[model samples]
Target: MVTDRRSEFEATLTRTAEARGQEAGAALQRASLLRDAIHRFIRNRAAVVAAVAFVVMVGFVILTPWLSHGSAYGVDFAQAYKSPSWAHPFGTDEFGRDLLVRTALGGRVSIAIGFAATIAIMIVGILYGAISGFAGGRIDDMLMRFLDALYGLPYLPFAIITLAIFGTVNFWTMVVALTIASWFTTARVMRGQIITLKENDYVRAANALGARWYRVLFRHLLPNTLGVILIFVFLELPGVVLGEAFLSFIGLGISPPKASWGTLAQDGYSAYEAHPYIIIIPSLAIAWLILSAFFVADGLRDALDPRTRET
Candidate 1:
């Protein structure tokens, strides 16, 4: 009787523990999984500084122009080449327009292009990669082959060629060109991630439970891959902005009256001997924006890395 009672007591304790686990598993899992990442990200000094700087820069670029009555294109030859002052803090360009206003407007355009292209690229690449990875076999082979063909093409030259053929690259045209050139990387990354994840025990369990292919891919595989994708997204933006600026600098980006940082810098370069501030200001803006993005990406990678989670 004593031995039987002891066995029953142990069984009762096991049952009680399982019941408590079932009640709190989700909450515990969520906190355990996310808390470390969040804490690490918050503790990153450079990342926090960069984040604040980026937000401030973007807001100043966008709101400064709107807050004032100055036109980015308004010419005042009388005030030409005036150095930084209260009337023109960034000074006057060759056209005698307020450099501050023009630079801010340029920032607006450059950042917009960066964000729009990244978003489009992410959506297309994720879908293509998820489909290719989850539906492995001949279908996967064909899709990957197609991706390879696109990936092998020269991105910069092809974008230039497309712009030349079109003869009128507007905002939408540039967005499309950048999207086409950039999505290949995301597709490659996502495909590899999904393929490995699909073989994991959790994924296998979901499949065994009669989850549809689409559900498994989108609901399970996709979310798991998002941390990597998001990190890449920020990392890609700086490159996109730089590429757009380079094109604009060469006279191929969005045409005049619609200034980009590249155009602003290019214009500033014309009278550079007399007024270097014009060029200097826009160049500083670009560097700051790109560096800030890199800082954030580094922070994100550190936060999400499982190896670093314990620290």
Candidate 2:
């Protein structure tokens, strides 16, 4: 009797603990849903601020050329290397072209290149990561080996070789270079996330319900991972911009006649003794753009992390 009573007591205790755990889990889920909703609803007031700044910056870069009466390329010996004045704000370069116009054009190229490269990286990363993670086993092993092989190679050397063979840094080439060099990092992060997500109860339940593989992967897995993906994308932009600028700085980027922040900076630095405005203006623009992206990204990192609010 004593033994039977002891076993019954133990079982009752176990059931009581499990019941409390379920309740706690439900409470936690409700709290998490509430927090996520609040974060979305507010939309990071800081990001809203950044959205405004980004809009103004984009407008200035894209619209100023159309708005101005004179062309960016129009040269006047009289205005060559002139100081910033009421008539010619941002001054003129060595060729007497409008510094304002060149800088604006440069901004357009830098931002555009960054956007293109980042998109390509994200697409490749998402597909590669999701597929490998879901398939797992030998397929995952083979795919990861390929990824590791690429990662093992020296990146800068590879970039230099690829650019040298291509012999141009036009729009497509720039996109290719950035995409090739950058996607691995995204792929690794995404693979880890997929591994964690694929094991979730909902994903298993979907599989058990006879849902098709593609539908389950896309409808259930992708949507759930979007928040994480978005955060990474924003974080990646600054790195992309910096890479474009560095490539341009080294003369391996968007070639002359087309301006990029790096090319502009290169020109400015070379002529610094004679033309201070050229370097100073473009450099400042690059600084501002980078800073704006970084600040917004930082705010997002803080707000999006689930543990942040809990702590």
Best of the candidates, TM-score: 1
**CA displacement after TM-score superposition, residue 210 of candidate 2 (Å):** 2.6
For candidate 1, list the clashing residue pairs, or say none: none
Per-residue C-alpha lDDT of model 1 across residues 1-311, encoded as one tens digit per residue: 99999998998777656544533563475467678878999999999999898899899887999886655787778878889998778888777888888889989999999999999989999889888888889999999999989877888877787777777888878887888788988888888998998886556655655668887787667877767987998888998899888888888887888799999988988878888898899899999999999999999899888888764
Instruction: Give the alpha carbon lDDT tens digit for every residue of 202-233 in model 2.
Output: 66655655668898688667766766677777
Error of 2 at 12 (Å): 32
Error of 2 at 145 (Å): 2.3
Clashes per candidate, residues 3 or more apart or on different chains:
0, 0
Once model 1 is optimally superposed onto the true structure by TM-score, how far is the C-alpha of residue 197 displaced, in angstroms?
Answer: 1.3
Clash number for model 1? Answer: 0
